[model samples]
Target: MSSLFGILSAAGQSLLTFQRGINSTNKNIANVSTEGYNREIPVFQDLPRSGVFMNKIIRVFDQSLFSRSIDLNQKLNSDNEFASGLSNIETIFNDALGTGFSSDLNTFFNSINDMLIKPDDLAARSQFLANAQTLVGKIRNTDKALEDLKQQTVLKVRDQINQINQITSQLAKLNQSIKTKTLDIEVNNEYLNERDRLIKQLSDLIDTKVVFNEDNTVNVFTAKGYGLVVGIESTQLSFETDSNGNAVVKWNNVADITKEIQNGQVGGNLKTIDKVNEQLNKLNDFVTVLTTVFNKVHRQGYGLDGSTNTDFFTIDPSKSGTKIDASNVYINITDPKKVALASDPKYLNSDNTNGKNLLGLKNNISNLYTNPSQPVLTPTEEANLKASLNDPTNYDFIKTHTFAEFYNTKLVAEVSSTSSYIKQQQQNNKYLYDAITEKMKSITGVNMDEELINLTKLQRSYEASARIITVTDELMQTILGLIK
Candidate 1:
């Protein structure tokens, strides 16, 4: 179907095609260990009555695998943030760290029990006051710590939002470049690689959806259907603070869509802020109820100074309300002699009846320590308190237990349970995320062995094509000698 010159030209074309294939294999081998690198596949097309033609080189890509990987990565990041936040909260209440509120509470209550035995001893009374002061200081410090954590979460969220904006902008720019190259019928493997990498990065900061276009541009969106990028244009996300100082993710500063952002570091930071605030609220409530009940009983007793109605602990005057918060709790009475120890004693100096009565009040104080909202009660205390209330005759003052039973049973137990649940969730997420990530790598990742095999094949083809060119030249030389 062709002449000798045509045959020679065809052989030369075959040589070039094979060389290009070898070059592509070499590139693949070079980047085999590169992170996020995809294997380049060289395409070949048969020429019309010729040998072969080299087509464009494209990287091996699985769009579906890539999209799924993005989703899993976002969730993995969110779970990590959540687990770290829960650990921080656990540290706040960890008794092993020597900073737990439970320790201070136990010490203060033990000091009070000792005071009940030596109500007239001034030294015991002073120790009781000192322990109470220490307890208050611990509560205040804990509250401050939680506040600081909340602020940190807020700042992290703001930083994440900024990063997200930056990522989306870059994606938009890459989208435009890719579209232009594709429209011009140019090879765009580099642009495609960059775009895929950018999309994955965007998904890590925030959950994203990508829709590919015919022009090689992709439209990116938030999981909530907010457009991140459409063709060449992109929108930026921002955060607006609510009156409570909570950071709310906003779409163009128009709507409050904080709840829509889930499964990313941004979402996790917001959720962490909420978790920290929840624990802070519970601690404040405990402080309020403790101060209220203690002061209530102290009010019923007479001090050594014969003060009939003295408030041992006071709420801040500006913040005084029906309930006392930890931030506002203060020791109202300063004089150690002002410590109440008599309920209806004949002499304030010699009366241990009030101290004994205060101990008796511990049984009734179950109602104060047990948060009706949370309803976290020790089963025994709940049943006993119910029974005592129903039949006051069965109430035993000698068997009363207050602070120790309630504090451990309610707050400490709750923190432990929450921490355990968060840790389990993190482990499960990590396992799932790792499995998916490995799957994606297997699909798109370069294989050195496979590349070597391809390289050998290309080398053989190149040698064959070179031999054909040499044979054609030798035959032409022989024909020319015969003609001469």
Candidate 2:
């Protein structure tokens, strides 16, 4: 019961609807190689009577796949950052390269052996002081390297926070644009894609959570529930120096979240900073042990000049602090004749008892060099290994395990083990991230051949609908001719 004009109207509307489908197909073909682009499908709904109309779009995406991808990306970044920091620390302790504290320590102790053999040799005493200076330089350099690494990591934390804030701010803008244009399918689709891209980028800097809203807006939060983006407003993260001069991450520039972050670049930086501080603390303890017992013994002995009660180790006068920090402790005796090598005034120049005693201290401190075949510590020994760190004067424990053992087993080995673990974790995370990415691509990636076929079908439909319109117009013309 429809008129000819009604037929023309349906055909005309169908042409536009089919054209929309064609445009979408062409777009899919055009963007086939675009990264992070999710191909879209234009859904057409049948009209109540006899026509079809273009409806909403169904973006090809799986939320679960996207979430997993972000998770793995953040984890991989964390491992990468940790590995980079540890690499620098490993270089500091590379003894095989002849640049570490081991050789200097050996030379210093060998000088003591020379003095014990020839008590009248002032050359032996001078060589000992020279070797001691070299050892002190090595320790100072190691401490400076660790401190530098920590400062660099702290800067990384601050930089990551800034990056996170920038991403969240951009996300907030996208949310506003998306909410305003929710009804505009084309514009909103692009906005959603951009939002997803930004979210993935944010995950690289910090661990975050993304929630999709009913109105197509997204809200972002930290893993610990700190709001980053909500509706159209974004809360930013900031960094400040705490009382200890360590950088602390904060929410709204107030509440500290430095320890709260556990993954991504920020988490890795925080964790590496802790490790640097640990090494510094251990190095300080080692210095305390070196200066404490060496000075105690040297001060009790007598030099050729009958010098008595002369301290062997003191802070560099040029330095401002009194603490015997690793970086500040130096050789205080420059005069070879001032070297204390006698236990008695009766035989000050002839007897080498004090020289022999000093050699004994050196032997115990570097025991691993002379006895490398010592068995791995028992449980009791392992428990006592760290006791010297609290009280470095515990010569009972120090003598057995030796300073060389503590440095190698505890310091060097810790870096090596952590590096190995992180390398493995980085490899595992890459595998998992790749697997998830492949799945996501299969589901959302554009298929050029499929899109071409769809384009052909849409073109044919559009042509047929145009033909109907042409035929109906001719029929109307003929009816007008009859009326004339």
Question: Which candidate number maximizes lDDT?
Answer: 2
Error of 2 at 315 (Å): 1.0
* lDDT (Cα, tens digit) per residue for candidate 2, span 1-484: 2588788888888999999899888888888998888999989988864477998778887988998999999898888888888888888889997546876777787888888777778888788888888899999998888888888888888888888989999999999898888566877788888988999999888888888898878899888999999999999898987664577988997778888887888888887887787778777777766676577667767888888788788998888664677868878888888788887877778777666656666646432222345322334643454464644443344556777776786678888999999889899998999999999988999988889888999999999999999999999999989999
Clashes within 3 Å, all models in order: 0, 0
**Among all windows of ten consecutive residues in candidate 1, which has the lowest summed lDDT?**
390-399
Stretches off by above 4 angstroms in model 2 are 48-50, 363-399, 474-484
Candidate 1 residues lying further than 4 Å off, grouped into runs, are: 182-187, 316-323, 360-363, 366-406, 474-484
Reference-based TM-score of each model: 0.86, 0.89
Flag clash pairs in model 1. none
lDDT values, one for every candidate: 0.75, 0.81
Q: Tell me the deviation in Å of residue 343 in model 2.
A: 1.3
